[model samples]
Target: MSAVFEAMIRFGLRLAGSQFPVFIFPLLVFIVFRWRAMFSSVRENPAARLLLSYLLVVFVLRFVLYMSGYPYQGRYFHPITILTVFPIAGGLLLIGRYIEKFKRGNLLAWLVLAVVAASAGKVLNPPDPKKWLKDIPDAIRANAPADGRRTELISVVEDRRLPFYAKSGYHLLMPIFGDMFRDAEIFLADGASETGKKLKGKGASPLDLEGRKGGIKLIVRFDEPTKLRAIAFLWSLTPDKMKADVSFQTVEGGDFLKAELVSSNQEGVVFRQELTAKNIIIAIDVKSNSLWHLSTVRGHGFDSYQVFTQGYYNGMMKWLPEEDFKFGLQSVTQAADEWGGDNVFILFDATIPEVEKALEERRLRGKIMPVGEFTTHKGKPLSLYRGIAPDRRD
Candidate 1:
């Protein structure tokens, strides 16, 4: 039932193809019945029954989850490996008895060899741990806070060894799962899933989506009114000159309220407006035929301390929510905060973009520097960056 156990099972199955194991189980069972003395009491044996029951439990749970339209990741197959280990071992031993009784040739020996070869060929290869990430927990722990009890360790890596490995020290939070869905996401602007079907022709830029007339309308609605103290958008424009009009709509709707008109300039990205609202809707009427790449947005609040989103993926690259910049800075400044220490650690192959600018924009004057650097087994370099002190909210 635990995520850790499930991941391991999927890892094992991936190492060995499903076809042979799938066939082996039923065949082994059939062989056992024919030769009743071959662990015939296995069905009655409590240990054998318990493992077998666990296998069925995982199988049904995974089946129900996948059927309900959760992203069909192959990781779900992992737990069955662990749950079936005991049952399979006894079954295999039973099958051995059948093999010895019925066959007198090298057929069984050759089958085992073939299964091993097939497994090695089809097994999935998990990535090697990059130096920065592998060392970060320990490094931060080395310089750990004096009473490091409640600090929640956050990381962008999807590795399963987090909170488990972290049981002794920092309380690790789960990474941002890529395929986690939101009901309100059906309204995201220019997102691939929202427009992919509508964009049937070549020039679909001036097309209409949901209710927006032209261009892209980015809408975000909080169930209750919230003060957005700061927002950092990691965006790029195609044309030399471009501008966007930001707007908002309240729960009581009569007319769309004008918020702030922003344009990219030499002073980093700028927008002058109180972003506090129940609902913030940005209906962009882009000028100069420009294309925009939205990278990240960070909303700072008490309960919503950290929110990072890969806003839109256009078949190639991913974008982010402007979150970690503030938290990354806290990683150092509040390195020794008493309760619920605020620090956000993220993962990247190249580097974290606009980290310095993010701190500057938020008026947290500091430098974004890499902490640990190391190469992966595949010769890839990685490092973790954070806004180091002299950083204070303006």
Candidate 2:
């Protein structure tokens, strides 16, 4: 109970800092400081007393309503002022009558109109944005099997435009692009990812152990014996409190191995280990009470792995051309495969030579197929590919 009250106090303080309703603040401050003098008419006038009661009841009711333990946020509270304004409006009209006896009424009316006009523009033109995966939703609806099959889109925007836009019966699996967009931004804008970072087996996002010191566990399984050379534990910003404990497992035997902390920063933590496991379980022990947002976790031993992401910030805020191709394609694919989704759409510019060469050599035929080609608005060659016969099994 005390904690909730404390939270409310903090909420009120934070909101007061904004000093909103720019036109009303001066009147409110005057009422607060000189309430007795301002409302002195109430003692002698019945109408004035009724107006005071109305204004006071609005706020008193709101106090009771807010204290009833509902979540308090800017969207929910403060609107009660609409009710409080009725009495204020009535009082203002009475004051207008007094001012009319002096000839200031027209000036007051014009001032009110100017204030309304100043605030009207922002209210009419609200700020909202649309997602960029246009035509992909319609494409899925047209081609997807009506037997209620699920298709995964390789898009990273936040709107869930792929899943939400699909008809009720149709199932769509799309990547959850929570601030992982920052990863793409960092890569394209600065190229600060681990210099020799190699893509290994794609795995699930790291699970919160719920303050359990037991560990963060990842199951790494492959057909043949693959030497676990490097394991990159993609983190959610702050991961220093957690320690790495890498282990290996095989049909013959299993052993726990020590993992070297290659590097650590806010983006993620990179750990390197030399171990062998056909099916291995690597666990990371987290310190208590720390929140870790694990966007992705995977092991790297192969030369390169398929990345899945929407090509770049093209439509809407089409500021960069072919800028985010590599980061988006690579990281998003890793998360998609882990989450039981197969990307059906892929696009790229001439920036990624490896993908271009792979396309030339038909190296990605079993996994993905080239679909179409076009030049970007900025005159960059853009090629589209669709994932083919994707393995969506658990």
Candidate 3:
């Protein structure tokens, strides 16, 4: 019932903002005050009756789905919008007639025309892209090094599409997602399960542990002892009453030594430390009989390229390991801290003057060197810059 009410409210706002702009609320009040007259007007028109009936049926169907807990989003509101136009036109006609009876027909007609003009303006000139982020990808590609040396980039700009543009010789690194997890092999206690194998290589798929119970032992082994900067176990759907015991083997054929569990919750577990290990063993027991999913294990180490970005999508697949590349993090920096890199390219929307200001003032130990500039589809500017490392800077 609550969900249905929420959906109705959302749909109402969308309808008013789109179809019935400027007069929906006042028209609604008029209908409430003179419902008999409005009903008589509607009832006399066969076209009005059919249109209203169709709109009502659609609303009822949506209400039913909302009551059943089906998700309601922008796409779901589209059909309702289409069904509403006829009823809105009829309502406007009825209102226009009432106003003419009161000798204000020209005023009411002009108000309706004004609303239509406003809506047309919105359609003709849609909202500009957020800070011209759409052009960052092109800016990065245009400014990339021409000598073909592998270039590692960390974009702090709030753009999700930037990662998809990472191809050819460009490597996009998200510090939050470690680099070593890609090369590690996952094995179940008895052997490699079909689900376990799915999580082995690039673009690893999520693990669905729904409805299963009891202890599950999984081992992640690397080709050699790998230095760990960060290890994160991500969950798409977290289970209830879950606990994980983590241990590491620092040497080949060495005894598994217990590693302190940094943090654990229904969402996932994260261990941040500097350690070298050949195998990581995770023993998990699910006590709740509920649906949950384990997405992927991500890690960063000395072997992987190090870069940080504050603008990655939460839903992006983190299975791809950082390709063997040459880049390093000189220090740990906060999200708000200035971004710095040696020969490292950074792409950001230049429309926000504050972004460039923040970068110059707080960079770890480098100066920004502009490499390329671009104008977005809507004409906002995007910028690409290279950070000159301390040694590289004269």
Give the Å shift of residue 128 in candidate 3. Answer: 5.1
Worst 10 residues of 3 by lDDT: 284-293
lDDT of 2 at 145: 42
Worst 10 residues of 2 by lDDT: 284-293
What residue runs in model 3 are displaced by over 4 Å at the alpha carbon? 1-20, 26-76, 104-111, 134-171, 176-319, 323-344, 348-384, 387-394
Q: Give per-residue CA lDDT, model 2, range 1-394, as digits (tens).
A: 4534654575566445533364355445446654776567788878768766775675455444444322245544445455445444544445556567878448658645655676687578765432224444555555444445565544222235544564412211122222222222110001233222221211211111111122223322222223232133232121334434423232222442222232223322222111111011222111110101122222111123223333334233211222232333444344434433334454443334545565446443234444545443345454444554444332
Q: After superposition, how far is residue 298 of candidate 3 from its true place, in Å?
A: 14
lDDT of each: 0.37, 0.37, 0.42
Q: Which whole-number lDDT from 0 to 100 does residue 330 have in model 2?
A: 47
**Per-residue lDDT over 83-186 for candidate 3, one digit per residue giving the tens place of the 0 to 100 score:** 65544566677667777887853766775897689778877996656544445555556655565544445543334566456441233333322333334444
Score residue 300 of candidate 1 by CA lDDT: 20
Tally clashes: model 2: 6
> Model 1 lDDT vs. the true structure?
0.37
Candidate 1 lDDT, tens digit per residue, 1-394? 5434554465445435543454467355755564464345557678755665676788777755533323356656668655545445556555666687887776556656665676676565544545544466565455333555432443334343543344322222121211121111213344344323322112222222222323333333323222131111211111223244433332322332111223223321222111211012121211111111011122221112222433454453333333343344343334323223223333333333443454466554433345555455566544444322233322
